[model samples]
Target: MIDEHRQDLAAEYALDALDPESARAFEAMLANDAELKALADDLRETAAALALDAPAHLPPPELRERILSRIRAEAEAGAPAAPTATAVAPSTEAPVPSGGGRNLLPWALAAGFAITTAALWMERGSLQQDRTALLQEARELRNRDFLAKVKIATLSAQVDAYSKATAVIVWDAEKQHGVVKLNNVPPAGAGKDYQLWVIDPKYPAPVNGGLVPVNAEGIARVSFSPDQPISKADKFAISLEPAGGVPKATGPIVLLGGN
Candidate 1:
């Protein structure tokens, strides 16, 4: 029963749209249900990734009226309303042109065509922006990663399910600082988060590194350093943790690397 209720809240929780009470309740449930939590995390991650990948588009200004006028005019003529501008926002620019059911068809078709072209143009512009940003980010990451002196370890996804994902941990032992770059992992679902762990043999349990927030591409750059300096890191791993991260790992290990 609780799991059933949580299913409904999962997406909302991931989106942070749940009310405080609902969120707290969901978190409580997440603590005990590893399978449910893992599912939620995957869903949330995918949703986040999709949102980032999707382009935001606004319709051409005149597309709205051209559509509404045609519909209203059709009704006046006692004819069925024609299909409208599919991509347009609500029409606030102009009202239906006067003159009952007259020669508005041609103008409407032209306006619809113009709007479609304009939407494509806008989408192209958005895609260009995305490309520019991606290129710049890639350049910066390459320069910093390759040129800067650092220690790096390659991490492998733990299971076949995550074969597409990749991870690398870079650290400056002298500075006692590190960064984890995880790429191509599907986004964590709502109310679920990916977390990093530093496994030291001396310790009874793996020390929590922290929650990792990933982008739409499932790319996450997590900057972290352990609370206490260590002689050496035996290994590192990433797990699908509850949202905001748990004090200790209580979920499946998704990625792993040895020192």
Candidate 2:
């Protein structure tokens, strides 16, 4: 049996009213709980139908009169009978208007409409916020997808000494920069650092990308901008060089990629 708390969670999930963490938790539960999933699906369908399928129609003109008449009849039926004997003193109370009860209908309708309009206005603001957030999230995803598509190269170990190393160079020619990621590569020897190079066909030699440092876990990620403009990055390479880096690669190239 789904408890009241779970039912409320399901309702909020259906309405997209839950916060991110709570929504994720509820979705995790739904994956394993068939009954909860079914209940959530039903609530979603019901909520959608109420929002989209309900027709807008005003109450009939006679509806207000009927309601007022019923209220008056009930009030009169509940009142005690008037005293049989008449007293001598005249009353001090103000006279009641003859149409006093009839006047209540307009005021009642006005109050009801005011409350309904305020509620609808609040709902409209909340929906607008949700739409803005969703649009932003979509834009971020699109940017990431575009970046993924432009990845120009993936490099692997070129020498048996660095056989376990894996590297990738994600270049963005438009921005004149790229990111290099290395995994399972051994740390550089003492007083030596790993250097990166970009072989541009226009240059006589490779352009010094930068020094790379690997953590104990053999993983390194560096954002690099080459010293020279690369008309075409024909190939990328990583080599062992003295501390800092070298303008020219004197050590063996351990990792290489591209034609």
Give per-residue CA lDDT, model 2, range 1-259, as digits (tens): 4555776677667656677899999999999998678657655554443333224433356644555555556655865685587675766888667564677799678756864565456455555666688667644653455333333344557778677665656566656777677777888989999999999989999999999899999877777889998878889999998998888889888888754
> Ten residues in a row with the worst lDDT in model 1?
142-151
**What are the candidates' C-alpha RMSDs?**
20.0, 18.4
CA deviation > 4 Å runs, candidate 1: 1-150
| TM-score between model 1 and native | 0.42
Per-residue lDDT of 43-85 in model 1, one digit per residue for the tens?
4554444334335554566655565565556545874576674
Best by lDDT: 2
**lDDT of every predicted structure (CA atoms):** 0.67, 0.70
In model 2, which range of ten residues has the least summed lDDT?
49-58
